[model samples]
Target chain A: MPSPADKTARPTGFRVALRDARGHLDPHWWLVAPILILVVCLYLLPLGNVLLLSVSDPKPGLDNYERIATASGPLKVLLTTLRLCAITTVISIVLGFCVAFAMAHVRETHQRILVVAVLVPLWISVLIRAFSWLVLLRDQGPVNDWLMQSGAIDQPLALVRNELGVVIGMVHYLIPYAVLPIFAVMRGIDQRLLFASRSLGAGAVTTFLKVYLPLTLPGVFAATVIVFVFGLGFYVTPAILGGGRVVMLAESVSVAILQTVRWGFGAAQSVVLLVLTLVLIGIMAKTVGLKKGFG
Target chain B: MTDESAGQDIRLYGLSKYYGDFRALDDVNLHVAAGEFLTLLGPSGSGKSTLLMALAGFVEPTHGDIFVGGSSITALAPEKRDFGVVFQGYALFPHMTVAGNVGYPLKVRGLGKPEIAAKVRDALDLVQLGHLATRLPKQLSGGQQQRVALARALVFSPKMLLLDEPMGALDKKLRHDLQLELRQLHRRLGRTFVNVTHDQEEAMAMSDRIAIMRAGKIEQLGAPRALYDAPETRFVADFLGKSNFIEGKVTGIDAGIATLDTADGPVVHALGTRPAGIGDSLLLALRPQKLMLGPGPNSRKATVETAIFLGTHAEVSLRCASGLALALNLGIENAQALPAEGTTVELGWDPAATVAVRPD
Candidate 1:
């Protein structure tokens, strides 16, 4: 990379006066300096304090971190979180891909309606959505009643207060996240590529697999990063749906903080979630960037 | 690209495609001979592209039977039709490399990797883009991307190649160059090509025959020179090129020559004898180049209105005594000599140059 001074070597190029500005700060930074400072003080300070407490409180050291790595309790919570998030990501991506694909090809007014329908759920609070799912999936709910009345099931099935109920609520909450990104990408794809593929003697299935699917990988990768990260930090949905039976990472962190009052351990778990989400995004960004250009 | 696939003759019987009440292609019938390069030439909404798409099996005709090599393919799927289509916008797979795109048809045909790679190399070489095989479509220039599309379409050597405005996005120089290259390739491959374009110059220069369409119907179909020389209708003459309409009444008919009395004076149309009688009003389609400056069999006294110097020729506007305006393409030699605006001069042409047509 060229040095900053070299880049601004021509006076007309930048005229930043890097040396004269306060410790290399551009004069333009002054306009947003107050807001930037406030963001750091209010937002980053709390986040940094959380990380600091993970190692400082209760005699400090790596006690909370060691427990996260070695103890079965923290490990089990992490495992459950990872497993459920993976399942939710997969299901949401598959279902959202279908919705987005349909939206991409439909008529203009119909596509508008579909886009609103997909995004409207996000406006509804996750708490309300989770309760709705709980009501629908629990024993003696309408679904179970219908199944029993149809003679399909002898009794109400175990649907709520478990992993299944939690996944249902999380997938519902995460679906819009999956759909919007994928839909945006799918809409930009030229429909003629499909026709061109077909005319080149590739069948519909082959064209979808080879041309359409590859073109959509960037969107899928972005959705996976979003749905998975959002699934990790999800608090209310899992709490309401899990009913204290299927404890996940966020729920465990809440217990350690509010009930057991282990702020250090909770903060440690929070840092773990932050690191995991960042690492996933980092990995996804590489592949997404590689396939991002499609014009 | 292959000896086994020379070309296939295509026949469309009473093809009609209707969207609600709008007729995209109304009662169209056409026969393209084997190994012929035919162009469907028309302006937008004239259904030229629609006809090409129908042949490619992308657009199904509401009522028609399309036969290729004497076998009906009206119900065949686009993939099953085995036609190489170079779509408008090229539609190169952005995710795939150039070589991958060119190899796609062969890959779908289950060709071995070695054979596919070799053939892709040859196809790229055919378009003279072998070195850019590994680059993605977005990385190439527009003309390069167009060449890649051509390579991919011709890679598998399908029975025919369909191009929908293949040069629609190109500039004039590149379009002319590609037109020449495409024509040479057609001769080399001996494959039937059905191209759709609104550019009349492209149609005239590259096509073995041109099918001029208007309002979902073929206005005229013939070889380029034949169509230009003897357009059957005013629309054909106007759309294919610029034409000056002259109204006249047939005053005499003798010895296969018809003398018409125009407002300017008497003129003769000795090209050929047509269905005409004395005192019959007629419309003549006279091309700009056909209108000469010297006296000839058909002569008209006119005053020059304007003369604009173009590279090859100067386009002069003339208003005859009848107040009928005509455009003339004067050669550079005459353009350099003289004749200022409003200068009165006698404009003449061979009687054969004036083609009689219906007033429409």
Candidate 2:
């Protein structure tokens, strides 16, 4: 019924066009596809299920998210979690900068020793580190025993079962995580740049501030975002070190799911945490660039 | 020739540099006059760059002092020494625009915004790069970037300018063009420029005087013409240009010219400063271009081994004896009657054309 040109154009042209489009796609797209499918099934689908449950469980409505904004205690919990994560991120990034700078220029033998020290903490279980901190900082524990022995204090100090203890444990764990990315960036920087600056008449401190600091800012931004995101979803360190006293969003979500038997409320809290992490990450990606931000 | 206006006296006294057990520079001593362009010419690993680095304060000499204008600068830092350095790779800041890179030294010196802008504009204009002031280093061509480096080095109008193989990265034609331009610029600026290069032609064309160095020592140092005409050693003669070496014994001396008995014949050499007794073995350096080919007055008979016809001239390789060979250039005017290969021809040169040089 059709002419030969029209008949060829119908299927063969479409087939060639599709083939060209497929060729234009990145060669590594196949490797990326399986991971993307896994993430959608294991992470994205579950997250979407939580969002649906937060609104539709028991009844199809936005009642649970509404309660988050309206209820006084839930709003306070959200604010506390945000504030704690911000503080922990700042503290860890500062400590990480010093450690990374030291590692970047240290002798090879000493650098190996320092690397082992940092990685040793990473390999130790998070629960074990929290327990160790609790033992050291608890009232009438070794810290109080030392202070009483030194006669600096008349009574035991309140060190554990509080936000201070929780922040301390969190920073200790997150600092090594922050150091690696920043150190990688610092090490790759050309040392001649500093020499060039000095040759151009800049003093040592000025050269460090003007040339060295600006180049490493991307690494700092990356470390900050990563540490903050990891801190947001932390549970064990806060639970064990906070001694069930200071409540964070993750610990609160666990209570809602287990103790209150309110799956809707727990899912709502999780979805909020996930949304907050994504928002921070999005802003970071746009500012410092995606590769350096993740690096 | 000495000029009274040239007073930027640079003195290096017993300067030596050692890299552990290996000596990079021996006890090197040199004096450069003001407003003179002196080139440290040598092959790689010959310590020419090391001498320039020492002068620029990038390298610390192990055993001596560097004096600029009769004041020692050994303890001074590079910036404090106030000598501008143009590196081999140009080393322009990749992130900065042309104007920004040129203005960096001014900005570091705490110059005002308007002053830096004006100076940067003038410096770029001097190098004919005013139009590309806003482009980044990577955006410009290699020649353009090299010009930027030169402008950056000269922007501050320092007492001395140190250039370490500044034209090493350039293409041949570009390098030739830039060489003439650079010599003109040097004459106009009248600043002391101490350049390091292994390119012999570049040194011949650019330097007011060249210091030919080998094995961490100065083999010869003189004006370009003086060095070419009266090279004191075999290394200097071979390094400055092509030369046909004829080894023999000094048989006679009349006035300052000495005559040597060689395989080809008795070759007379102009002995300007060197003195040699009779029976002393000598090696004479005869320049190829100085040898006039074809039969004429003062011509010697030789058999042509190879003849290459160049555009302007032809190079004829002739054998004088069993093991002696001489290269002679025949101008295009004489190329019409060029001798065929294996043909005998007469090659001629003036009586005082060659110089007696010390064997390496």
Candidate 3:
């Protein structure tokens, strides 16, 4: 057989150089190439175009950003989006924790059923879910009708077409996303540590507070990041349930581009949202230090 | 390092546990003396660990009560029992420093910070891990982790220390060293220790009294020497060490001595407390070390099939003319004089060296 040096000496071209580079790389890198190509074309290209349009679409340099900084309407929209996202993240995390804890400790059959209950909503169309929430929370809906008829209220309550309806719809959509990452981490915790804690003279509440709670912090952190980031970009459920009354940033961006034909302002708002999301994530990662957060 | 008061005595009265239809612990009654080391020895799934868990108040007994210092504690929760347990895998908290882990029990008891710190130091020093107090459990080696576990368990100075195969995860040399350290610790503290293990040599090395369990019951409980020298059943004899079982029929009983008629010849032996009748079958448990490989009154001709030379002694497998196989443990000097394999030799033993045991 010819030696490796002899075989390499016979090939000298771009193809050979590519082959040589491939030999030095891990074989698993090849499996990732297709997804990498798709992400660059479908995600990165559109994102880069939006960034360029933010500065160059209309009369150039800093006009849209100046409007974002000084205009009261845009500032109010930004504050409302941040407030709604925070509320949705906190509510989703609390509800998701209880569900994931139940799923982790219940019998195997019950756990399977609970997992399906959490995941089945994901398979349903988001539009259909938003419409169902709209019907349920309307003025003449079943909840308001029952409350008025039962003497619990003197008048039909305004449950939909408002901020409350938008939050309700957003939290409902964000819960399954919160549950998956938290459940994954919670299941990996070693159970023997709990028994050891009890045997060392810790009561049930104390054991949970001292041992069980600390071990599940990594899971809680991951779930918070997921739910908060998803809540920031939420548009469909809020749009349907708000009934055009509660306007979030995503809706404002669409109105600027489609109704008003202000492409630079819409693209500038998109760039601001992206930058804000990244800055928030960067702050959290610095505070927790990703290695410690995952542990 | 805490005050070494005499530990409390524990007693179990007809303790039993049933998991659906399978009995994990069946009617176990035992007494643990104050300041004694008692070991439960058995094979896997023989309920040794189950019995330990029942004692620790984790597995509630179905049909009985446990008493510590003459007060029934059967209904008490595990935290109320005040017993420290070292689990099989050590189970040290991976997130806590060594000092933090050791100070946890005291912290839960509402002690002041300075006192907790002082006690934690003493406890770690007791296990000779004082210098490693700042290290997390994941940063330590396996043996160091085990010591940290021991220190954490002993920090509160519990009434009794319970260990479930504490050294089962260590390699052989580390296991031996830890066994010695545990023995020394038990002696120094003078606290009641209940340990569970399947290794016979470990049980023999560390236990003041051993309870050999089989099928969820204590088959025999006694001092280690007594159980080894005079086991009451074939299972006990075989489990504790090597033994040769000789089957024969009783032919005569005269003056407390019974003569057994074997296929090779008649053998005379002093009858133990177990009753036997003429013409009834009897089983005898004879230790391999008790048989001599030379001419004597109880001598029998045998052919050596295989001889294994160990440094201290040699084990020779022999077969008699009656087709009974016997093992002879010869000393180094006597082994040097042994003929080659397939050579015929004489094996003998004193009548008092063999004991009658239940067949099963």
Candidate 4:
């Protein structure tokens, strides 16, 4: 739906047609050029600055990158970040599959209600959700008090300010991301396929494993990539729920730059996170093989 | 063609399905013999698919029992019933290749890898899709996908096969081709097939017997020729094919023929399986092709209202002197040709040309 002025502005001359795309740019480039310029000025230049600072600010060479493997503290932070992100992604995808399956099968009215329930938490501030979890899950919280009153446990359980709390907060924040893509895939699946599988002599479990599971795998893969990448950069939820005990990569980067004034180290950690996320996406994209699902 | 398991006779006794107040399937009692191909032909909401689903065990009837070879299977699950159902959309697993789709039943049966591979190859070859074994379902054409669905349904060698509008999605030429292939496959397999469709022509072409349903009830059940020539009800007469009805009252009886007094004239109707009494009031159902433009035992002087050329025949619409409208087809042999519109023409037919049907 381009304007008539836009249509007339295109180079429709024979000279332009003779030249290939390398010189005779298509009109589509006009729309993209502004966004490209904005991204370069607002995002890429800052990212380049970080890259430059990471290598040059602290005595040059591979000193900062080398410390990731050499130093135990930063190495543990990296390990903890990977571990929490993985756990959160796995938990979110499993729960999201169930939620999405229900949403896909239910009547339209019920499905809409369930969708709103899943989405409401996403629209709420992450800081609020994290605090709510913190308030409910703390050692002296109502959960522990109820369990103790019910004679299930004599002592309170440590639920927050740990790796478990960070994982819980991250998974809660990411379930919406997981559910949407999986639900999109599930909605495209014809219910007759399940009936066909059963008619083919496959029982419920076998049909699910062979037919239903494979059909929804693309959505699962998409959710996994999405949730994992989004989880990698989490700052507020982990900071509030972790209670400063658990150190994710983003928190570590913030500490280096703002608190410790170690800009080079912060830039190095950002670079590491970016490179790792891109690498993981590359591996997953290959495994996902875009041509297969939703065809 | 494998003799390990042959077709079994399926019986539905007092089968009925009620959705709240609407009856999806009324008390339907049917017995399909071994190796017989029966079709449930009806319009939407007439319960044809509902009956087929009940037989497949996907739908549980409100009160009835389904038996295969004298054993009741009313309470059995769809998977346990051991019946293959070809869905309307083919429902080929998009994630699986053609070979994978056909071999799924065998795999679910716990067959070994090599055995499943060999059987899959045979099934693909049966459908003439051996070259496209590794291709996904979406890669193939509609006809190829349909054949793949048929192959997958037959690969398990089930006791019975149920098809729900197998050719509903194909174009005219494709539907015609697949109809021939399906008939041949049914012959080769020799399995009792219960197909469901609203297409009268498809049912008439493929089915050995058709159960025409209406309003969740079986209006009539018989061979295609028997149903067309001698329908018991007006619905059946009109549904099976095009038919012209003349509202008449029986006035006389002679041998098998019954004379009915109509506004146009006294028309003679040949009594069928359900004979009409002398004083009974019933409608006469006449085939369009049977009525000719000439004088006969039962004749009507009519004005030609309209004439449409239909390749091999011309369909003539007539308005009789008594204001009775009628339609008839004149074959190519009618060298007299169609009379001009608004012109007078004499229409006639023999006693055996029309059947007396109960008004529905």
Candidate 5:
């Protein structure tokens, strides 16, 4: 039988190039072709459509973007979204660091229990979790009832249908995302370095502050970016917990497209959110460097 | 580099540690003199590293006290004890540069910026790493990282320097070079140094005194030369270096000289403190280098089984008529004139060359 190399020798130009490319390509690429096709058809195609609609619909060329800049409603929604995402990122990261540190240092049996506690929420549906938080934080909810019964307040507190409710729900949803990366980095840190620092005249607090914290910074930074980005795109939890009272960017986009039937404006808002998230990630990557930050 | 006089003596009184039913350290009592270099030499499970950790305040003894400069420091935290420790793999902070790592201890002490900078520079220069001050620990080679660890540990002028197998991760050549450098550093700083290692050669090379441990107990403690010359037990003799044992019965004693009757014949010698009467069994420890291949006052006829030429000396294995195996370190000059393997020869040594040791 003639070798593929021999067969390729007879082909000219384009055919030869195609044959050569096929011969050199990895056979394993065939295994991933299905997933690649699915990503292009389901993800990239819709994203491209959104980008096109942002400029083409409603007479094209920057009208929706100008409205986003000049209109008060869209601007207020943008600010609220940014504010809620920032607050959620901070609270989730701080809580995640404490939980990750505890999990990393705890006994093996206790670590398993803590890990399950952090991961169980991820397995539950986001809508279900948001609904549960709504039920728990409402005026007639268990928390408010308990506070009233304990004589801490004369009436049930206003806990849901606001920015505070949106923040609480988003933080609850994003904590596992924050915990995983920080916990991974914390586990990789050598425990002996802590002992070395302590033995070299650093007290427990000093060792934790200087050695342990710095070594775990890469994890913390990665977790922060992940939580912030996830919070920026969050819709279900904020929509359910906010009870239509606290309108975020995602809720505004839905209102523009479904409630008002303004497709170009909704698509434009989405494009802006996407660009903003990318720009934030790019700036962070440039400043901290993904490699060094993770390491 | 700041002060050569900054060192404190350490003492352990009946120090012991237990892991459930297993005893890690058993009633260890040792006195490390100020500015002295003492090594804990033992096999892997002999608790040498545990003893070093106890000294560094990482491992708490179950029932005893550790005193530094005549004050009991058993309950003091490791940082308060002010003892510098170089771990097995050095444990340099990967995120910090060499200068930053060296300055860490000073920074923890709340030293001023200029003072910390000067001290960090001095510490790095002392370790000959001043040029690599800005490089992270990961960028340096193993030996360089080890030097950085040494600089960091010594920057704060610690009371005592505890090393837990500091050279265990280096190659043979690097380990040898670091051993010499460490010895010189000990001499220059005049700091009390407590090093732990399983390598007997390293212990003998750098230690002023060595405590040979076995099964959680110290079998012997003395200077390197003393330990090599007179091991107290068969375990110590075997662990420190090679030794040949001769089992016999004590036939007579006169003027501190005891005559022993072996299966082959009666051998006379005066060594060891164990008292023995007639018909009592005793063991004798002999160094192979001391045994000569010729007829002397105490001589035995043996057949050579194998002879290996080792450049300066030839190692010969021999078997006597009574089935006793012996090893001899023959000089190259004498070995050149010796007969080939399977040949009969007479082996002898001076009675003073043998020492009495308790059998394991």
Candidate 6:
């Protein structure tokens, strides 16, 4: 028989469980809880609701998902989206790596200028940046003007209002994101390690390959993921620069939702995009592990 | 790995390093024999580490040439120079297992998988870390981490070995243990080692010869006992170890020994090598152990200011009328019956005990 005080007090087992839970949860749950809840409320819940609406509309059936699987238009849009993002990720990562390497090795004054040049565009409106690229890369724009004036070409090359213009604009926008991560990793890399490698009998190129490249692989992976994921959801850049001729998934989804009023179909397309992004992230996380990939 | 007998002689010619207007090293010249353990010992700002870095090809000298085996290697990169370096921080790659860290050079050299594994095993065994090859650097204690670093540095038998305060981060006892191990390893390998350390005792214990540096220049370079007995300047005397400076004026010179009139009283002392003139100011560096801590014919009366009982010996600080504070060590037997504090005591030294050095 337990005493009155013992009966009223929390059980030892339950108390221990509570303490263990608090120990695990206290650090992140308090600080990150608000943001996590916000993501659930604003992002996850809406996405989940879209999933439900895609299947449950009119009747609980798989019609919307069937459209995704069988419909040529959605399938085409998905393929185009993947192809464009792949190309953009490749271009952005290569260019960003060069720019980041230059930034890391340059004089402090030059580095400041380069940093501002990359980051200042990020703070500007994305729509405005896309418009600015249109203004620059259009057939009669400054680039073609210079090319024609320099007698490099007899006429303006096809530079704008197509996949080319869309890619150019997207790469321009994604360059900053790609550059920042690669640069951060490049900066953290022990410069001595490179010297150490070279001193140990490796030539410049070999040292770069063995030491610099492997060390910066994590950063490259991160940049690729960021550029690819961001490219998947991009709307404004594609709309303004692709000139309504090129059809990316976001544009197709918009048409399905707003023009055709196929809300279920649009939701299914969005769900597919989100799932694809998650799948890619999961693969990256699996291969590199979370720590190195995010480092 | 090449046999230790193939080690090359290292020579540096007029090596100098400067950071804009600040000179970190100036006109440094040094020669290390094929299998000698030479140490560059100095205080923090004395350019000892810089000299080691210059030789290792990690720090490019602003001017001068370095040669290995009589061939100029001024343009050789550190790795290409084939010199092993144990960095001051140990610099074990935290991501690597102990075996992985030790096997890096061989791996980089594109050794076959089986060869690499065998070499890694051999290297770990050399450092007595074969059982702990799977452990990461972070899992090991500081002393163990340092041993792993040593194993990594010695994994490939390089042309020479450079250590920059390799045991600086260890505790005294650990440092002592590792110092003996290093000395033994050096003997076994028979490869020239250029070690940089600020700890004079460590330098004295391990170096075949020690180069004492001050203000970006070597003040004295000689055998450890030679340096201890015959320092060239006051700075070299003070920096190497503890010394009681007795400023005096040379009163006479006879039979290659200088008699000086010291402030503590008249003292006749031998000038080991250099000769001094009459009325010239002479500075004598008296080692604490040299002074006798009792009444003698050549003794000066001193008041016992403080006494500290060191484990092996007792250090007694005495103040004389000349306001010179002197430290004298008393062995345990003598320390057992030490004069009480505030009591007057007589301290003296033999004529050959003190070294006459030029004030810098």
Among the numbered candidates, top DockQ falls to 1
lDDT of 6 at A113: 99
Q: Which candidate's TM-score is highest? A: 1
Per-prediction TM-score to the true structure, in the order listed: 0.91, 0.80, 0.89, 0.90, 0.89, 0.88
Kindly report the docking quality category of candidate 2.
acceptable
For model 5, residues A1-295, the per-residue Cα lDDT tens digits are 7676665464343342322534665445666789999999999999999999989888879899988888998888888888899999999999999999999999999999999999999999999999999999999999999999999999888888888888989999999988988998899899889999998788998899899999888788888887888888888888898988888888789988999999999999999889988987786687666664444
Regarding lDDT, does 3 or 4 come out ahead? 4
Pull out the clashing pairs in model 6: A199-B78, A199-B79, A199-B80, A200-B79, A201-B79
* lDDT of candidate 3 over A56-76, digit per residue (tens): 979779889888888999988
lDDT of 2 by residue, B66-141 (tens): 9988789998987787677778878776667899889988988899999999999999998999999999988998
The residue pairs found clashing in candidate 2 are B8-B34
Please provide, for model 6 over A149-268, each residue's C-alpha lDDT reduced to its tens digit, 9 standing for 90 to 100: 999999898888889988999999999989987898888887766655554556788778866898788789888987898999989998999898878888888998999988888888
Better of 1 and 2 by lDDT: 1
Record all residue pairs in model 3 with backbone atoms less than 3 Å apart, i.e. clashing: none
lDDT of 3 at B327: 89
Give interface RMSD, every candidate, in order: 0.6, 2.3, 0.9, 0.6, 0.8, 2.2
Instruction: Locate the minimum summed-lDDT window of 10 residues in model 5 chain B.
Output: B1-10
How many steric overlaps are in each model, in order?
A: 0, 1, 0, 0, 0, 5
TM-score for the A chain of candidate 3 = 0.85
- Flag clash pairs in model 1: none
Candidate with more favorable, higher DockQ: 3 or 5: 5
The lDDT for every candidate, in the order shown, is: 0.89, 0.85, 0.87, 0.88, 0.89, 0.84
Instruction: Supply the TM-score for candidate 6.
Output: 0.88
Q: Compared with the real two-chain complex, what DockQ does model 4 have?
A: 0.76
- TM-score-superior candidate, 3 or 4: 4
Question: In model 3, what lDDT does residue B21 have?
Answer: 90
Flag the better candidate by TM-score, 1 or 5. Answer: 1
* Candidate 6 lDDT tens digits, B258-278: 788877778888887777889
What range of 10 consecutive residues in model 1 chain B has the weakest lDDT sum? B267-276
What residue runs in model 3 are displaced by over 4 Å at the alpha carbon?
A1-32, A276-295, B1-4, B253-257, B261-270, B273-275, B291-350
